[model samples]
Target: MLNIVLYEPEIPANTGNIGRTCVATNTRLHLIEPLGFRLDEKSLKRAGMDYWKDLNVQTYIDYNDFLERNPGAKIYMATTKAQKVYTEVEYEPDCYIMFGKESAGIPEEILVHHKDTCVRIPMMGEIRSLNLGNSVAVVLYEALRQNEFAGMNLEGHLHELNWE
Candidate 1:
């Protein structure tokens, strides 16, 4: 299973949408402390729809706490400072794909320490970054695609059709 780590997310809707994505992809969600909005916010619930309850979410006191818990885990930090494109890295199963907050992004210390594992989404425009939820979807889907979408339903459609 892949892990999607949100470092001090500032927006409820983004986290909520990311939660839905995690649930859909069968990945785990790890949230760092100092969240900007409450988890029970209406905007979040609305964005996540009914899948919020099914999301596998874990909260950490801080980045160090997260590192302590998942010792030796392969982590890929998504940042604009990284030189490597996100798709260039070969994602391994159980690898953690971490994203920073809406405003500041991942801490400099962590990025510096794990510089080799840092990756970024290439953008042609003048924008510095993409939406948090969209970025998660983009990277997570790429990882899943590389892994052959192991646990996902690849068949025609999710629901069976009865055309009589």
Candidate 2:
């Protein structure tokens, strides 16, 4: 399944929403700290609601730890500076779709290090970027669509609806 990684995410609500997305899609959510808000913050818990317990979420202390643990996993940095469109890439089953904080995109060093894997969502006019939560959902669903929405076996999991 596709993995969602948020690097230094700022908003609790965005993280909460992404947690819900991960739960609904059966994807893994990996967060690289330090985060702006606590996971147990009222806003986050509220936005995530009951789905927080349903989400398969993981936390990493830093990027180096994530890299060391998941070697060879394709790390695609979503940025406005990239030349390739995200949809053009062949989405891998264990790929890491990484996003940065809401106010700024990923660091230049990481972008340059993973230049070939960098991708961007096309935009028009003066729009710089999409909301953090929305961007994760868009990229995640696209990858899931490419993979035919695997592991989404909702048939026997009727009890999930009662989660949130």
Candidate 3:
């Protein structure tokens, strides 16, 4: 299964939305430390609604801890500065897609270490960046597509849809 890592997320709603995506896609959600909002924030709860309980969310003290715990996994750093396009990379099931903070993005030190795997989503018309939640969704969908949309089944649970 794929892993979605967010480095120092600043918004509860974005994190919560990403959690929902992870739950639907059966991907593991890894959160790096120093989040702007608490896990129990109202905006997060509202955005994710009840699906938050079913989400497989993991927390890490920092990037180093995440690296230490999951060594050898290919980390694809998604950034605006990347020369390679996001779709060009051969994403693997063991790969982890890392997104930077909403305010400043991934630090240069970390970006430099994983320069070869760095990639950016395509944008046009002077758009500087995309919303964190939207960017996560886009990349997660792409990864899911590459993996044949694993764990997308919810056929019997249609009535349980939160529909937020």
TM-score of each candidate structure, all chains considered together: 0.94, 0.90, 0.90
Better of 2 and 3 by lDDT: 3
Give the poorly placed runs of model 2, Cα more than 4 Å off: 153-164
Descending-TM-score candidate ranking:
1, 3, 2
lDDT of 2 at 134: 88
Q: In model 3, what lDDT does residue 27 have? A: 85
> Residue by residue across 70-151, what tens digits does model 2's lDDT show?
8888899999999899898988888899999899979998899988989899989889899999899888988998998886
- Model 1 agreement with the true structure over 1-164: per-residue lDDT tens digits: 99999999999999989999999999999999989988889998999999999999999999999999999999999999998999999999899999999999998988999899999999987898999999999999999999999979998756778989
User: Which pairs in model 2 have colliding backbones?
Assistant: none
Model 1 scores a C-alpha lDDT of 0.95
* Cα error of candidate 2 at position 150, Å: 1.3
Clashing pairs in 1: none
For each candidate, how many residue pairs have backbone atoms clashing (under 3 Å)?
A: 0, 0, 0
For residue 52, model 2's alpha carbon misses the true position, in angstroms, by 0.6
Q: Which ten residues in a row have the lowest lDDT in candidate 3?
A: 151-160
**How would you encode candidate 3's per-residue C-alpha lDDT over 64-151 as one tens digit per residue?**
9999999898999999989998888888987999999999999999999999999999999788799998999898888878887765
